[model samples]
Target: MNLFTDFESRIKDILETLESVREKRSELDFGRVNVEPPRDPSHGDVATNAAMVLAKPLGMNPRALAELIVEKLKQDPEVTDVSVAGPGFINVRLSVSYWQKLLSGMARAGVDYGRSAVGGGRKVNVEYVSANPTGPMHVGHCRGAVVGDALANLLAFSGYEVTKEYYINDAGSQIDVLARSAFLRYRQALGEEIGEIPPGLYPGDYLVPVGEALADEFGTSLRLMPEDKWMPLVKDRTIDAMMAMIREDLAALNVNHDVFFSERTLHANGAAAIRTAINDLTFKGHVYKGTLPPPKGQLPEDWEDREQTLFRSTEVGDDIDRPLIKSDGSYTYFAADVAYFKDKFDRGFDEMIYVLGADHGGYVKRLEALARAVSGGSSKLTVLLCQLVKLFRDGEPVKMSKRSGDFVTLRDVVDEVGRDPVRFMMIYRKNSEPLDFDFAKVTEQSKDNPVFYVQYAHARCRSVFRQAADAFPDLNLESVDLASAVLGQITDPTELQLVAKLAEYPRVIEAAALAQEPHRIAFYLYDLAAAFHAHWNKGKENPELRFVNDKNRELSTARLGLVHAVASVLKSGLSITGTSAPEEMR
Candidate 1:
């Protein structure tokens, strides 16, 4: 199934023969060797520079070493030819039967063709879209949601036991403000003339429905209660309503979390979980009383010389020790976060990934230090910083303002441009880089939009199938038999070139999974799509090259197998990223 692996194993056998003939005068170093597809097909199927890396160490000329390796590899029937190219590089041309056999394996494997066991059953917890429960999810949240969800899917496909988690910030002052805003709407729902919303309160029109619902349920009974009694009631109601809205926004983007850990639930009934986390740190000698020098560069305006309870984070690789408790004896945000991560470790996750906004750039190192310090360096944690997304409409940037309480929700963009374009563009680049989401350009059914281009290619293949069915009524999809046919019949240059891309699927999935970069899948799909489109368009110029030939049923059925494999892989990859592979373009 994996042609690259087959070539690598054959090359390793050659290395073994080279080792047997050596006199043991020097250490044989093949550690840095790598076998991969050459950038230019003219070079060969797989190329390696092992001889160059080993020449100086083994005290042999690189070209001589390469010649020895090639002589040894001539014994492998799988390697049709091995050449010493350039100074010491080895280029290997695998037998054409290797590729044809691979296509057969792919057809039999179906969607599971590229699944990997790279994770080896390691447990990983991925936390994403931990947006505050004060408002609905906006477009800024879309990128992180998709990246994190896709990352989880990628890891799971690679055999990791993965957990998709969302951290709810329900215990902060922001939630308090949300409650106050909801109380204002409750009064308005009661027909009270609560004028324009104050500057500090949420003013979104969505809150109006929440207010009406509250009035309908409580019947104005909370009006006479004191602020303290009503605060908790209002806070609970508002958070319940807001979290519901946030969930709907995420669903529109095709995201769902396995766990929704609420911050308030951590301290339910004043159970003192944050204190327990600090006390556990105390046993490890990380707790201390210290006055941090005013944060270098820009000090907070209220920075004072007050001694506070601090954690010796610098010992674990932080810039400096950080305050665990504020001057008023309340746990800071860092303390609660520490407790949450501890819970993750306790739940048996061997590795963890946190997806956060670029504004949280400073939080990465310190949070990592906390996780390491708590887990005694036994747990591995990685923080993926998602840079800001600048949304564009008609080539103009959309600005978000908290004052109007009307932001561009994820639902808004998905409803306007659509889900596939949004998912494709979000992961089309590194997550650390800022993205430009232009609504006008993404919806265009042109090559300019990558989503449409890939989907169009898949749809194009289906068109070929429909046309082939017309010319031949008995084409059996149940037995997509390409193995029995002489693959040499696919002699068109365009057909052979497209097969080269299909050959890369297994290796491509492995690399993308290993780097924890789902965006590479987006890039690979586009490349495959481009190759397919080129082959499709070339048929117009040469009628014999068309997938369906009225005169030759044998040639058409053989090409059908490759088309089926292409469409299947495209569908699986798109599904992993929560994108649909439509069967038609128009």
Candidate 2:
């Protein structure tokens, strides 16, 4: 159970019973009432601002209302003491018995303890890592991939029906360049002495295998076809090969998408989807024929002063109305985006989230406006912009990879430092904040390294159980119920503090999911790890604080229950972050 949520319910119930509250019941709004852990642990177990928020509406003094609420709260059997602080805030100390019982529940629930129903089964589509299908995924796509995957995991854990998606940008000019690059490789495979790649072509050696595959499939036949005839065949094959490589790279980092929507689909059948979407907008008076003023600074190459088909996006939320079709009657890239959004809305997604790189920040408002215009404000849209990750090695900048031609591939990072570190460090910072990922620091076994520290905490928890097994060979160390029965012996303040941290997991998950910030989970996990490590260090100074005591089987078992709860929460959070909780660390 969520302790803060439980206490908030209890406090609101207490407020309802007050005579003053009954008089103003019809006018009262309890939405602002919430209970959270006290900012200073020394203050109490839980803190609330119920009096401060409700007193004005009730026409009563804040401190006077707090005292009244305190009296009713004092009657709660679970609450050991209740007090008023700072004008109107209320602090309530819970009994050790209450914490002990909560610990029992936590141990019984295991890793599933933090799973929540806050999302109410809302259908959320999280689309991320839509990197162009022209090449392997580089480090630039890595951060967004992990952020989006972790976010999907977080949302699912918090009870959302989450669909992880990848949007393939295969309909652009970049794909044409890829086909031309692959054709060169195919020629080279046939013993043609092709020189250095041209300025505009992809130069990576990763396409050598694709070239070989093309030779195996088409032999010398493809070389005889004209450019237009060969272009489509080569483009399709190259996209398939590149996506296969991209998927393999993503898999190496444990990222998998439920949907891989192709941009070409929107362009298929004479742009059927794009036409339908534009028609829908036209019927709604959101489509118009207009010309856009030249953009500030250097004009874009495609800018035309002549009139064209446009979407009245500004009427919804965009900064300016956007072009749908260019002067040449070709649909713009934004047209494909509109169709993509309509496709998602038609599929009955209640919310859509786009995980894009920081460079795509300009798309945020327009995408938000599209949701309003396309869904008629029925669906919500959110854009999470992940900042660039600067790579470093021992205080020096990392050089580019020849495998990727210019940048470090996602596989390069994963293969060198490992996937867990890559995934964890990618999420350790807020997505909107630039992250400096150092190869030397993340893999270090010290507490300064968050992933290692958090993983080590889980490993230590397992070690405790192993130690307990050897200390009491006859004891059923595997029985959560058995350990839970003896939790009353775990009365130390530090032990209870760990349980208090565990109790915050559900709250953290709900808050992070609502904020759409998975970094909060990383921050919370790190804090919990620090608290656990601190307590473990205490055992060295005081023998009584040891988790597995040979002289006291009952206390040891009780502590083991506490350890189980910590491990369960750590594993749960780590799983959400797409990092493994190892059984042991070498």
TM-score of each: 0.95, 0.98
**Global lDDT of model 2:** 0.93
Question: Model 1, range 1-586, lDDT digits (tens) per residue?
Answer: 7777766676666666675336543476555777788888987878987788877877789999899999877777767888998899999876766666677677667678788888899999999999998887877789999999999998898889999999999997788899999999999999999988999998987788888988998988889889999899989888999899889988888899999999987676663778888889999999998787877787754344688899999999998788888777877778888788888888999999999988898888998999889999999989998888889888888766453367877877888888889988999988999899999989898888899998988898788789887898777655656555536565555665666688788788888878889998898889999888888778888888888897999888878777877888888788778788999989
Top TM-score hit = 2
RMSDs, each prediction?
2.2, 1.1
- lDDT for residue 226 in candidate 1, whole number 0-100: 91
Give model 2's TM-score versus the native structure.
0.98
Error of 2 at 391 (Å): 0.2
Q: Point out where model 2 deviates above 4 Å.
A: 480-483
Query: Positional deviation of 564 in candidate 2, in angstroms?
Result: 0.6
lDDT of 2 by residue, 1-586 (tens): 8899898898889888899999989899898998999999999999999999999999999999999889888888989999999989999999999999889889888899989999999999999999998888889899999999999999999999999999999998889999999999999998899999999999999999999999999999889989999899999899999999999999999999999999999989999999999999899999999899988889755568989999899999888888888889988889999999999999999999999999999899999999999999999999999999999999899999999899999999999999999999999999999999999999899988999999999999999999988999999765547436645677899988998998899999999999999999999999999999999999999998999999987788788889988999999999999999999999
